[model samples]
Target chain A: MTISRVAIIGLGLIGGSIGLAVREMLPGVATTGWDADAAVRRRAAERGLAGTICETAGDAVREAELVILCVPVGAMNAAAEAIAADLVPGTIVSDVGSSKRRVGEALAKTLPGAVVIPAHPVAGTENSGPDAGFPELFRHRWCIVTPDHTAPPAAVEALTQFWEGLGATVEIMDPAHHDLVLAVTSHIPHLIAYTIVGTASDLEDVTRGEVIKYSAGGFRDFTRIAASNPTMWRDVFLSNRDAVLEVLGRFTEDLSLLQRAIRDGDGETLFDLFERTRAIRRSIIEEGQDDARPDFGRTDH
Target chain B: MTISRVAIIGLGLIGGSIGLAVREMLPGVATTGWDADAAVRRRAAERGLAGTICETAGDAVREAELVILCVPVGAMNAAAEAIAADLVPGTIVSDVGSSKRRVGEALAKTLPGAVVIPAHPVAGTENSGPDAGFPELFRHRWCIVTPDHTAPPAAVEALTQFWEGLGATVEIMDPAHHDLVLAVTSHIPHLIAYTIVGTASDLEDVTRGEVIKYSAGGFRDFTRIAASNPTMWRDVFLSNRDAVLEVLGRFTEDLSLLQRAIRDGDGETLFDLFERTRAIRRSIIEEGQDDARPDFGRTDH
Candidate 1:
């Protein structure tokens, strides 16, 4: 039931990192990879991202005991479809998508006979593509698996062990709950960052040059989040529409209250909210979820 | 005249850092400091935040050639008033407030007889209070000085030199322009962060523990900003009401556009805006305003 031969369907940051991690951490596991873009395939080959670089998705998954789709959420169905016919009768299918419910449903529909267990490793930098990945990207990060309740227990156990072997703490979560949680923690934060960065750039009173110069005051943090792969984010917003919109609604409502407070000169309300949020940051650092340094310990300056 | 005797009122992060900086960078220039809280004055004395930790604000400013007020924006007037009677006739008065127009006006009204200038060092960590003082905090940072055109050239030159000695690049800016620029750069970003963190914490569907656990996905950055001194931020929003409100209006408009795009599945618009903000981040890095490292090079974990 152990996963020994793996196929990575998209050699971007997540796929490339998984290939590298398997090579480094699970040296006995045989890894093969494929990318939709020929240029990325060439780059992945140059980096030796996998033991074998297959020309097509079907060829990559033919011998793989576990096939992981690492493409964007919008392309999940196509990637699953490409490998659906090639995957052997016992092959287990999985993916590294942000939104779990949609990706799980897509994989289940496209490859009805395969064991489909969707996973999302809550780890990444603001970089993508083959060159942007490293073996250590998933170390000490969370990997959430949303397997169908009816899926084979051995397949679920094997997938959890696979992620654990690559240095992640595995958690089993309901697909719908996973989407809702990620919507708050990841999706809404990114939307707010993208929105604010756009807002700063479009200001008529403040020059873009000045905004860049004084960004250390706080705006630079938002810029980093906003700089993430546009294609990936656009697909994320489109795929996880409901959860994102629901969270965004809450964010907008809270923002309106603060706006009213500011306009009314309600210092107590502002102070109370600002003070309350500090505890969350402290808890994050305490739980080893974030770096506990001043200014994220940005000493590269 | 060169500033040999400097007095810093309200010995918090900025004031204490300035005292420590003067001691490290300009040993010959003696520094006297005062804080309203007795515990803080004791801590400053223990840390040797200044050459002389004065018992009163008047005692700190008496016979000083240069005096800098470092307090919350709402408390600027009171901090200035504390030293008005004791200031020597030729002393140059300045402050380290976030909003220039309001601070400059406050200092001018409180100490009309003395030369009043307002300056804002565009640098700080989330940490505050006496223990947060560090001599190198201002290294390679920007310090905006908004001085009255009617002020003597010698005094202005001395103030600029003082900031430069502390390892800051001094920029002479108009008070109104400084307010608008900071509104976009610092104030609005903080406001949005505060609002979002508040929203996330109050979500009834998601457990607070889940939010803290997955914060590294992007929520952690906002939490750090939202953790800033609540009293200081509340005062900043209240004092810079007009500029913050104007910037908030623009931010809301931009966010609305993004909301519509998400609703309509306008991927191209999201991609374009996301791509545009990346350039700003690159410019900030190229200009040495922020760290070029991935994820702010946060290695404290």
Candidate 2:
């Protein structure tokens, strides 16, 4: 089925980029965008990200067949409520939300009339805003979808193909599994990045500047993660609070042990830890997740 | 005086890179290098990195007017002592060691007849060994010189000019100051990376693979640093114990505060810290340390 009319509820990086990708990859997709920031919506429309900018979520979802909700996790319910009444009976509501379960919970409660699917395209840069969005953001990345057990099979299949067409390898999994995997992989890492960058910011100016300059040694990557959309991460922590806290606890305990070993000058423990992690990096390289080059995905090639 | 004969003692990343850079950038500078691994020395000469492969540090330094010690911190003294008697009188000796005070102290005792200058060029990739060396490693980076007040002025000036000629902006500082600053900037950050990567590696297999796959989220940065020359970093932590421990203390306490804030669900505290860090990243960009593009140095212009 050709998708002509599409609604993007948040005109930020993910939403704007999805719209841009759809426009570029699928020629006739008519994107109608809505944003809390009116200026963002206007700019998105002006930049040809959307065919039209809608005045409200209600207006945005009205008559739209494919509605993409890209707002923060905390705002998903209200956004859902605002659009649910206006969503056409046959509309398929999808989200680019980080937390699938939370979005699924909101949609299950608020949008029973619509075919709701929770999606997370594991692709993005630290940049946010309509201008930062580009059509190629999703190319050569993974897009995971979590469909409710009771949802229509046709809707699930259509959404998978839609993402694949946008240059993503679609993986369907249970919402809980997605959360757990992401908690280890994406969520906990971002939380730690936020924490470390936060810790460094409290230091003296000269030290902090040195941290950034010599960041190539390791700290700069955390800075980039810490620079991510703050509001989005806060909600991620709050919504996925349990899993995040558990992982953070493990990380802290491990760090404490390493700190103690360093203080005691235990070369054995240090070397052991260093040696094992080489395997993890090796595994990533073998699995083709990481490029063999020094930089990740940042192809100097 | 023209640097007609240059001897590089140690054929690791820093030493080999220096040999390669000097060969390409300064065609007139004749170079000979030595490493414990004879095969590595042969490869260096084959790659045009050195004019000749010396059998020993003594052989390398034998009539060279400029002898550079490029061994690890712990090995600096022994390497210096081994070549001390073979050094030509009035020869200018310098080093590419990371810690200044320690290297300076060792060099002062080991090479009493030479004009010894301690220098550190802040350049590298995570990869090490002879093959890991690149000619452009020091280009456009900072190379610091820490000279004793009693040292010959001409020797210090010549060493500074050599680094400058290699495209490194030379900064002269006290040995103690260099140690303190680098501890905050480089050592502490590297220690933290090793700690975190160690944390991730200890996880169960299911979670471990996912960690690598989604490492682009942030953890990959730590992996690179964690993958750095272990023996070199082990020496750094052990040799610079006081500074590393002091910085680690501050970092740990700050990390505890973040842990508390997260447990307390203190959004404001988290927000304040996260926001403050963004400014440091901005400053790093302004300071010409980081690329200011939307996605950091990652986005290709």
Candidate 3:
């Protein structure tokens, strides 16, 4: 890869996974990582999340050729500012934030003259933190790289090669489109899962104990998604407000149609929609984006 | 177990699973199964899903002490009618339907004087049909038995023992309460998943191919659930319309709050709700209702 040194800010799941992945995949590339939380830095250091778990963000980025801000979308600007003074000229700055348009704009504004090529690796477990990361987390997963007008071709190419080295297939998309696509694929799903989980827990008739006990029906799958990091998701919604709201509106409209069908006992409408949705699942499995085994091949089953 | 011959009408996932579980757990108990679809019956026979894959519903339940209807809730009356004449007096009739109230009422109406105890095993994969069953499907899963006033205590005890024999924990609940609980735990979740999957596929700006490609970002999980049997889910919504609609209304209200929070950048509300949902996930894992591993411990991951 063209990039020789990498600096990763935020030692949580995404940042830690990237550090470990780089260690395993691109041994020649040196990595330095930092997290604002001291305890996390200690864990990252113990886990060897990077070649050097630096004490400060500036220290981590001082000699790096590529600096990837792996903090929450809401924290992207602050994280960028932390390393802006330390970043050398010609360094390509990027982020692993879910929302690209805002993150791209934030990084560009913070690091005035630096190359900012934002990217989001569309993969994660519900679990977060230093311990939750593994080197293979990105294997066979798509990493969408959203580059704006300021990013040079060479920088984007180098970043793509860096991700490919970690076993991710890179897709180049516009910042606006990335925000919209992920608003549908990731943001709305998380929002709905979180909302349903909250609703189920707050129900007066159905006890939370009962909901938890009988969750194997379908609720448990949602619980898994809803268990995702709060700060990260909270930032995602705030950062990608427009796209999330637009998609959420569409989802609400679609949901209303299904709700009316149920109310009217329109079995045909329900069955047709259910059947059509199944085709998408089949396509996802065929594309190797999900487990084909029943119930995600959960070991307990 | 007190019962000897066990009849399973409709050799699909649930029916076939009970048959296989019987063969694996209760070696002495005889099982006779019949499916409306001739193809499913053939597959059940090949898989040895039951001790005897009977040619007709009447033949299956002719000598059975317990007959469990495993057809869709919408088909319960027809399936019950098919075997009603052959059911001996004092035989206990039950069903593996998502909605209990309607199923309990239908079973009672179709087979007058027969002991009808409806039960719903809150367990399944996104798969259906004869090939999608296994002996261990019910292990560590909850089987909620809804017994009405007409159901004898002895019959309920025997049914509970049968499910226990298959390695399921039995919870006896009132039929109406059972519908409400399942509406929140099962029906509403399925409705939302189906709706979201349909929404994602139907999005004009976001191509279906792109959604499938980047689905690992939470959308794929919903797809797994949305891929559930169309007929079964349709029947569930139609039969449990009241409870499903009720829970769905609550879910919509909750979703609206989150949508508004996102629009208004109310991160605290989002963060607080997200944090609370994580506890439910932990409780589910502690209860052994779900896999504790990240990403449901999918083999590919």
Candidate 4:
């Protein structure tokens, strides 16, 4: 039941982070890492992202019991196609992709011989690359494992333990449900942030400068969200295109309604909406999703 | 000229914060604070929010050479109406409310005896009351002064020194210009955050919980903006109605373009917009407008 040998198939934030988390939590575990970019692999090796830097995808996953495919979702199918021939029989294949359904389907289709356990560690920063990866990045974060009926019980249990051992609270859900939930939580929000900040970036000269200088007002929050990895987000929107558009359509309809309320000076409606949103922050605090202290529970600045 | 004696009316977040800042930065300055709510006044007094808590608004202004109206824009006129009778001749009166045009008009009409220099400190938090007051809150922030044509030179200089002493950078602009800039930078962003978070909260029950739980994706940023002072924001939207609506119109148009792009699976368009917005965050970071850290540069959090 012990996961001794782990191979991470990318040295970017998530893959390198998984290597670091496993090393810290499961000392003595042999870990191998690989990436198409030699510099990232070098950094991962120098920073101890893995116990060993393998020469190729095949070399990385050759003897490992678990192989985590932590590449962009748009590239996941291609990566799966490339590694399908190299992945050992009974090797548990998982990923750290934002979208579960597409990655799972790609894995099932491209690497049917391997035991695929498509899991998403629902955590990240607007940061990327090997240097940005932290051992505790996944700690206490949710990692939902979407294992279809075809996924073996032993494979699911082993992959779940691997994620749980890294301090993630593992949950099981269908890939389609996962896509819908994330469409609301992650994809749509990122899309909207990108749009609003993009809009402001296009403002007239004077206002554009003020927009950046006075970003503390609120526009900066969207910029931070918009600053998220472009390729990853681009892949997310493309991969979860259907669910994202569905939720996004709902959001636009609601936005228009509120816009009408504001345009009409419907103070009661605006105030009511405002008050209800406050409770969401409180609930987030109570759920341990955020710090209870003011401003993400930071007691002191 | 030394701003030795100061009166802060309607002791909420801004009032109490100004009182706290003055006391901290200028130890010998005399700060007289007043609020309509006896409970609020008591809390300010208990927290030593000022040198003394005045029994009435008039009492707070009677002996002060400088007076700051730190109340909602809606209440600014009424608050000025209450204290105008006791304001000394040539006394410098200003405000710490948003929407400079409305507040400036209220000042000119109600406090003609005082030298009116309406200001808006573009800084605040969602928390209110005396306990939330912090001296450093005004430091490193912009304080916009909308000075009237007849505003005495000495009064403007004195108010400028008062803000500078608290580590603020003051910018002088016309009242309408201030309103328009803020509507684009602050008001519309706050309104957008409130609406989107509100829209997410009104989602079906199961989804609503997930929204709050996984809010770190981007929705949490909106919640913080949405959690801002309701009455103050309500006043902001109402007072600066035209500007907010105008900026909001631009935003909706941009959003609609994005909606079409997403619907059409235009990955290139989404990526381009997302990439362009990244430069805005970079500019903010380069200008030191925000720390290149999480939670939109709230270093405390």
Candidate 5:
């Protein structure tokens, strides 16, 4: 069952990018899209994000062999329910949510007997909305597809091929494990970034102007991450609450240890941890997961 | 006094960059540099990090009008002491340490009565050592100069002018205040990054390969920062203990609030803070402290 017709439920960064990518990479595949926001729908249409920009979610999914919900994780249930009545039987229902377990459960609950195969494309920028996407956004990125025992083997294969057509390498994993991995890699990092940026801005001793001036000193990197879509992140934390809180607990514990080391002037302990962390960085670069260029090659220097 | 003969002690990233910048920006000024590490001195000579790569610190500063120490903050005392006997009276001594207050005090104590001015160029990449130096590192970056009351006005002005000549905008700040500001800007950020990366790497449920494979999901940004020179960061935390601990306390408090919000599913609180941080990011871009492009424009996407 090759996916020939696809419907995207939200025309934000992820949905819009999928629409553009499907058109570019799989020319034979037809695409339709809809957005909750009228302005975004108009912009996605103007940008030619899909072959057809449907006015309603139900209309969008009526002929789709695969329907992908790209809304915030918290809105997955509503998005799934909107298209449930129109989705053809055996259509592989999936999503591009950050948290898999919650989204998978939501979709299943909302659309019983649907072939719900939740997936997460671990690719994005600090930008959102229809204007923030491009066809190449998923190129060379990873898209993890999580399928439960209920999903047919053919539908799972079709969803994997569909993501591959959009220029992403696909990995199969359990929904529970996906949630935990993403919590460490995405959710907790975003939470920490948001916290630090807020902390920097509210410091009484350091004015916001001063923080802005010296931000190149490392704070700016966190600011970029913190600038991510607030609605999306708020929903991510809420939906992936258990995993995020678990990893966050470990992070806080580790932080306290480092703080104690600093207080005691324990240079050896600090140096050991700092040095050890560098090996992980090298592994990340070697794996092509990050830019190896100094300062991520952000500036000319 | 115009700095005609400048000496840079400790030929690492900051020192080598200073030498190369001075040679390129102020051709009339001569640069002599010495590093405690023999291999580094050899590398510095091959790269022409300075006009003259001296065999000893005494020789490096003997004929110099301005001396800049670029060693780890913990080594500032020894680096300063190494050149004390050879320094010509009234030579303005400065350093490029991240922590200013301790460095200022260390320089003043080791080279009594000599003009000591401490400055920190808030510029660098994760790479360190002589080979990592680039002439353009300081271009468009801020260099904060902190001179005590004992520093002569003329010497402070000359030091400020020297930094300006290297394509840096110089801001005069109190050493204590500079410590406080940098704690928020650099030290705490590094500490948090190191802690988070360590936490990710040590997770039992998540394989190390899994962490690296999905790092682009925001964990990679922190890894880049955590990969910075470990010795330098260790010294920075130790030297700026008071300020680092104080600001860290504030950050922990902020994290706790956000953690509670996540636990309570308080999306409104998370959304508010996330939205507020975007303004800071915009200001950093507008002020030219960071690249406005998303993800620091690190990847093609």
Candidate 6:
């Protein structure tokens, strides 16, 4: 059950980073990778992203003890189906999807005989594609593994070890809870970023040019998050619909309260909320989740 | 009118930065500064934020040809009134307030004999206070000068020159328009950040510890912005109430569209909005408003 022969089925940022990290961290493990895009496969070869860049999904997973689908959440089921017939009967199947419940279901439904244990490595940059990854991308980051209770314990343990080998600290959680937590932590933040960026772009009185120039005042941070892969993010929201919608509802309600406070010129209400939020940021820095450097140590100026 | 003798009426990040920038860029011009906080004044003196750290606002403005109030928007009037008796009658009075219209009105009403011009340097870091000042904070940044139409041309021109000397590109804008533009670009973004951070913190199902640990996914960026000065932001939201409420209304409307899309599983709508925002980010980087570095070039892994 040790994940030594691994197959990576996406070759984008997450897949490519895993490939590079495995090469650097787990030298004994052999990696075979395939991408739906031929260009990504060629780039993976050029970057030496895997020990072998297989020409087909079946070819990639045929001998792999572990098959990790690294495609967008929407594409997970198709990827699982492609590898199903070729996967070794008891091969440990997993994915690097943002949302766990849907992705776990997709993998299980497609590869019924295989051990479908889904995980999400909560680490990435705004950039994507094969060229946007580096070996240290997952270092000191969280990798939440959401395995179905019916799945074999040995397979889950091996998958956890596999992620830990790549420099991530691993957390085990139920798929539903993972989705709910991430909805607040990742999904809604992105949704808000996309919305505000869109709102700023469509303003009648303010020129997009002006918005761009003054972005550093605060708008640019949202732009960075909003610039993340649209396809992946769109799939995330769609696949994790219930959790996302629930969180979005709460966010909207909270926003309305602030909106009312602003309209009423209630400085105390605004000040109280603003003050409460600061302690969490302090805890994030203390927990080593973010850099304490000012402006995130951006040297863009 | 030439502004050879300048006084800064607050010694926080903006005020301290101005003092340091003036010293670097206009060596011939002397600056005197005073802060309501005694400890901040001590730090300002140690950092040489001004040529002289005066004991009182009156002492700071007594011999100055120009006085810039760098306090929060809520305190602009009081800062103006504090220096009123000591300010030379023809002194060119300005401020670095986020909400220009209210600040402009406050300055005009309080120091009627002085040339009242309000300016907002649309530049900052999340870190504030005296120790956070750096001379290069304003370099390559936009400084919007909002002067009353009836104000003298010579005073406007002199104030423009003063900011330009500190390495900022100056744009003249109407105070009301400046408030609206900043509501979209700065105030609303901050409000959204604060709201999201607060929303995440209050989730009963998700632990605050988990939120802090997994923040690198996207929430950390919001936390950095939400960590900005609560008093400053409280004042901004209060002073720019009408504009902020208007922009917040628009933002909520836009967010609702995306929220509906998520609930309906409409990937296309989400993708379209997400894709549109990337271009604004590119423009911001191209215009030198934000650094083009990845993860804001953070090294604290």
Tens digits of lDDT, candidate 3, A101-150: 98888788889878999999999999999998899999999999999876
Ranking by DockQ: 3, 6, 5, 1, 4, 2
For model 1, state the Cα shift of residue B57 in Å: 1.1
Which segments of model 4 are wrong by more than 4 Å?
A: A296-301, B294-301
lDDT of 4 by residue, A159-198 (tens): 8888888988888989998888888777877887887787
Runs in model 6 deviating more than 4 A are: none
Ten-residue region with minimum lDDT total, candidate 5 chain B: B292-301
Candidate 5 lDDT by residue in tens digits, A57-94 = 99999998899999998888888878878887777889
Tens-digit per-residue lDDT, B166-269, candidate 5: 99999999999999999999999999999999999999999999998898899999998899999999999999999999999999999999989988988899
Which candidate leads in lDDT?
Answer: 3
The best candidate by DockQ is 3
Higher-scoring candidate on DockQ, 2 or 4: 4
Real A-B contacts recovered, model 6: 0.83
- Per-residue lDDT for B22-75 in model 1, tens only? 999999899999999999999999999999999999999997999999899998
lDDT for model 4, on a 0 to 1 scale?
0.80
Error of 1 at B207 (Å): 0.6
Instruction: Write down the C-alpha DockQ for each prediction.
Output: 0.79, 0.46, 0.89, 0.55, 0.83, 0.86
Using lDDT as the yardstick, the better of models 1 and 3 is: 3
Model 2: share of native contacts present? 0.38
Look at candidate 3 and give me any clashing residue pairs. Answer: none
What lDDT score is found at residue B164 in candidate 6?
92
Residue A199 lDDT in model 4?
68
| Clash count list over all predictions | 0, 0, 0, 1, 0, 1
Q: Chain A: TM-score in each candidate?
A: 0.98, 0.92, 0.98, 0.96, 0.98, 0.99
TM-score of each: 0.98, 0.93, 0.99, 0.96, 0.99, 0.99
* B181: Cα error in model 4, Å: 2.2
TM-score of chain B of 2: 0.94
